[model samples]
Target chain A: MTIYLPIAELSVNIFVILGMGAAVGFLSGMFGVGGGFLITPLLIFYNVPPVVAVATGANQVVASSVSGAISHFRRGTLDIKLGLMLLAGGLAGATVGIWIFSFLRRLGQLDLVISLLYVIFLGFVGGLMLIESINAIRKTRKGVVPVKAPGQHPWIHRLPFKMRFKKSKIYLSVIPVIGIGFGIGVLTSVMGVGGGFIMVPAMIYLLRVPTNVVVGTSLFQIIFTTAYTTVVQAATNYSVDIVLAFILMVAGVVGAQYGVRVGQKLRGEQLRALLALLVLAVGIRLALQLVITPADVYSLAIGGVHG
Target chain B: MKRALLATLTLLGLVAASPAPAFAQALSPPAQGSVVERLEIGMNTSQIAITPDFAGADLAIFGAVVNADELLNSIGQYDIVVTLEGPKDFATVRRKERVFGIWINRHSVTFKEAPMSYTLSSTRKIEGEPGVPPLDAPGIGIQHIDLTPTDFLRGGRLLEDFRDAYRRLKMESGLYQPDPGGVRFISSTLFQANLKLPANIPSGTHTVRAALFKSGKFIMEKTLPLRVVKTGLEQAITDAAHQQPLLYGMASVFLALLTGWGASVLFRRD
Candidate 1:
C-alpha cells in the first residue's frame, strides 16, 4: 500500500495520495477551479517535502487545466483571444516568480514565505467569496430576483488601449488583462495554483467579461502557465516527481468526471459557500501555526555549511 | 612483544574465519595494549539494493571477540558497541524566533561534517548506568559524535544548543537512533545487534564500526563497509533527473500534455 517517491525521497500510502487527489479534483471540477491551492497544502501536511509538493502540484494542474480547457473549447465557451493575451503576461510573470523562488530557497526562507502567502491570499479570497455568496443566498430566500449589471465598471472603462474579445463579447484594455494574467502566472509558479478562483472573479467583476466565458478562459490560460512552471521547476530545482504527478492526475481526472455530474445537481450559491468555508479553514490553520509557539524552534536542511 | 605476537596470531585466526575476502585488506595494524583483542564481523548482507518498493531494511551485525585470556573471560568485563554511519554531509540547523508576533528563522549554525544517518547500539547502557564510565568521554554515544560547526569560534553556547536540537530532530525522524541494550551476547565471545535503515536512508557507502571495551576502557575496534544503492527504476529515474535535467523536464511536460489530452478525448461525451 506504501510507495516510495524518488524525488520526494519519502514513502507514502498509495491510497492516501489517491484519495487526496480525488478529493481535490472533485472540488476543482465542481467549482471550475484548479485545486492546486488545496493539493499543495495537503501534501505539505502529509510531510511531503515542500519543494516537491509545490513543483509536483503545478504538474498536476497542467493535466486538470488542459482537460477543462478542451471541454470548454468544444462547448464554444472559451475566449481564445483573451486567453492568449493573459498567457503572454503569465509567461513573463512565471519567469520572474521562479527567480524569486530560487532566491528565497537559497536564503532558506522559501517554506516560510510560501506559508505566509497562502495564509494571506486564502484568507482574503475565502472571506470575500463567503460574504458574497451569503448575500446572494439571502436575496434568493427573500424572493428578490437577481439582476445582471450592464457595461464595465467606471475604473475599467477609464483604462486605455481597449481591445475587443469577440468570443466573450467584450472590449477591454490589454493592460489590465495582461496584468491579471501576470499575477495569476506568478501564483502558478510560486504557490503551485492555477489562480482560477481569483481569475474567475476578476473576469466576472473587474474585466466585466461574461460569466459563461470566465471559467473557460481562465482554464485555457492556466494550462500554459502551469505547464511552463512544471518544466522550470523540474529543470532548475529538480523537484518535480513525475510518478507522483502521474498518479495524482489519473485519480484527479476520474474524480473530475464524477464532480461534473454532482455539480449539476447543486446550486451555485451553496457550492460557493462550501468552497469558501474550505479555503478559510485551511488558511486559518496555516495562520495559527505561524502564531503558535513551536515545540522545537530548530529546523534542519541539507546544504553546505553557512555561517 | 608477547602481546603483539598474540594479536598477530588472533588476526590470522580472524582472516581465516572471515567470509569476506576483502575484510583482510581493510584491517589496520594492531594497537598496543596489555591484552591483545581480535575482532571478526559478519553482516546479513553487504549490499542493500534499494528497489522501488523498498520500505526499509533491518540489518543484523553479528561478530565475535577472540584472543581473550581465561582471566579476562572469568571477569566478564568486555562490552561491545556498534555504530552504523551513513555518508558524511554538511547540515544547517536554524533556530526560529518570534518577530512581530510571527515565528521566523532568525539564526542558524552549520555542521561541517555530519552523517546523513547514524545508528548506535550497545550491549549495555552506554551512559548514566550504575558504576559505568560515561560514554561521552569515550565517544561511544550519539551525543558524543564529533560534530564540529563551520564557524566554531562564532557559535559559543548557541552552537551546543543547535547540535542538541539537530540530534533531537534526527532521532524523531528515525535517522539517528541510540539503542542501549540493542546488542545481545550469545556467549562470552559472540555478540549480535540489529539496526534499521529508514526508508529515507541516503544512498552511499556506509561505515559499520564495532568497538570492544574491557574493564571500562577501550581495547580494540574494527570497521566493516556496507553499500546502500538505488536499483532498477529508482536508479534510472534519479540518474535521469540529475544527469539530463533539461531533457527530463521536457519529458515531464510532454507527458502531462499527452495524458491530459488523452483523458479528455477518451472521456468525451457527445
Candidate 2:
C-alpha cells in the first residue's frame, strides 16, 4: 500500500516505511542505542528528501528517547543535574544549529554537508567500536576480564567551573558536559540524530560518567533535544511530517520490544561487534555515493513552493 | 502593446483583446479570415478537490469548434490542441560537477515565471506531419512552452543547456507530459480533449487552453480557469503547517510525546 507524506509531498510504500521503522527500532533496542544514526541515513537512501528525512528522524528519536529515558528514570540510573546541564547546552546549541541548517539549505549545500558529517562521524565511531569489541572478545577468550583502567586526576579534573554530579559520583567540569550536549544538539538539528551513539562513548570514557547512569543520562537529554529539534524544524523549515513520524514511531517501538528480548540472549562483545559492522556498512554506503558519479547532474527545486 | 488579437481567454498571456474578440492570442500574427473560427471549452467544475490518496486524474475538457469551415471539417483540416498549464513559479535547475573527487551542485539556472506543471493533449502530433495540420509552433506544444532564464544573458550562452536539462528533468519527473492522441474528435464540431493531471501536479489556478488551427494556419484560441485544490487531511495538514506553524509544531511534538509515553506505559504493564 502507498501512503502520501504530507510534508514530504511524496507517495511512498507504507510497508517499506513500516519495515524500515521496525528494523531500525529492533537494532536500537538490541544495541541499546538510539536509532537516529541509522534511520536518517536509511530514509535518505529511500529517496525521502534530505530536509524531510532529517526533521522526521529527529521526531522519531524523541519517541524512542522518551521510552528509553522512562526505564532509566524508574531504575534511578540517571543523573538529573548532569542531564539538565547537558540540556541547557543542547537547547542553546540546537538554536544555533537551526540557523546553520537554514543557511546551508539556502546555499543548496545542506545535503552535501549532511552526508559529509555522517560519513565522518559514523566512520570514526564504527571503526573505534569494531576495534574495541574485537579486543574485548579476544580478552574474554583468553579468560581475562577486559576492565578499563579508570584515570584519576586527569586533565578534565583541572578544568574551571567544576560541579559535582552526586548520582554519577563524579566532580566533572560543566564545560565538557555542556560542550558535549551542545555538539549533540547541533547534530540533532542538522543530521536529525539523537547523538547517543557518540554521546554514550563520550560519557563512559571521556567524561568518566558511570556506566550505569550513562545510558539513562544520555537518553534523558536526547528526549528533550530531539523534541526541541522537531518543534523548531517544523516552525522554521516545516519539514516534519507527523504522518511519517507516527508510523515510524509505532513500528519502531514494537520492533524494539522483540529486539530487547533477542538482545538478552546475545553476548555483549559480539553484539557491539555486529552493531559496529552495521554502522560501518551504513557509513561506507553513504561515502560511496559521494565519490561515485550520479545518474543525473541537473536537479530542480521549485522556489517558494516546497523549494 | 503586443497586439489586439481576437482570441478567447479569461486570462492574459501577452494577449490584448479587442471589443469584438477577447484574450488568449497565439504568437502567430492574428489570422484575418472572412469567417472568424472560434473555440469554446466548458469545465464541469471550477475546482478539483484532490484527496489524500490522489495519485493522478484525467481531466476531460469538453469543447466545441464554433464557426469552423465545413470544407476544413470534412477534410480533417481543423486540428485542436488543448493544454493544462499549472501555476507559474521560479524553478531553479542545478547541475552537479565533480569537485575534489566528490560531486556537488556547482552551477544553477532559474527559469523566471515558469509554469510548475504542464500537460498537453492534441488531436495528433503537433509537429507538422502529412495528412494532419501541425499546430506546434512558437506557442503550441510542450516544446513550444515559453521558458526564459532569470539571468538570461548573464549565464551567457550556456542557458540553452540548462533549459534542455530542465525540460528533460521535468518530463522524467512526470510533470511535463504530452499526449498526441489524447484528444479525440467525437464529432466534427465537438471534441473531447483528455489531459492527464500528474500525481505531483501543483495545486493552483491552472489554465485550460485550446488553440484552433485551420489547414496548418493559426486561428483564435480559448482558455478557461480551473482551480486544483488539495482537500481532506492532506490539505488540512499543509494549511496548519504554513498558517499556524507554531501550533502545528506543538501538536506534532505533543503527538510524539503521547506515542512515546504510551509505548513506555504499555511495555511496563507487560
Docking class of 2: acceptable
TM-score of each: 0.86, 0.84
For model 2, the superposed segments whose C-alpha errors exceed 4 Å read A30-49, A75-79, A96-118, A149-153, A158-171, A187-194, A208-213, A259-268, A305-307, B1-33, B129-134, B153-157
Q: Tens digits of per-residue lDDT for model 2 on A1-307?
A: 7777777766678888989888876765555567777788789777676778888877877776666666666767679999999889888887788788888888776678788978998899889878877887888899998466334448778899989999899888999999988887777666656767777766765787755577668767777777777887789888888889988988876775566556556675676677678778778987987888998888887765333
lDDT per residue for candidate 1 within B134-246, as digits (tens), equals 44336667888778888757567888899899999889888899888888888767889888888888888999998887655677788899998887787788888888888
In candidate 2, the residue pairs with backbone N, CA or C atoms under 3 Å apart (3 or more residues apart, or in different chains) clash, namely none
RMSD, every candidate, angstroms:
6.7, 7.1
Chain B TM, every candidate:
0.83, 0.82
Predicted candidate 2: interface RMSD?
Answer: 2.8
DockQ-derived CAPRI band for the predicted complex in model 1? acceptable
Clashes (candidate 1): 0
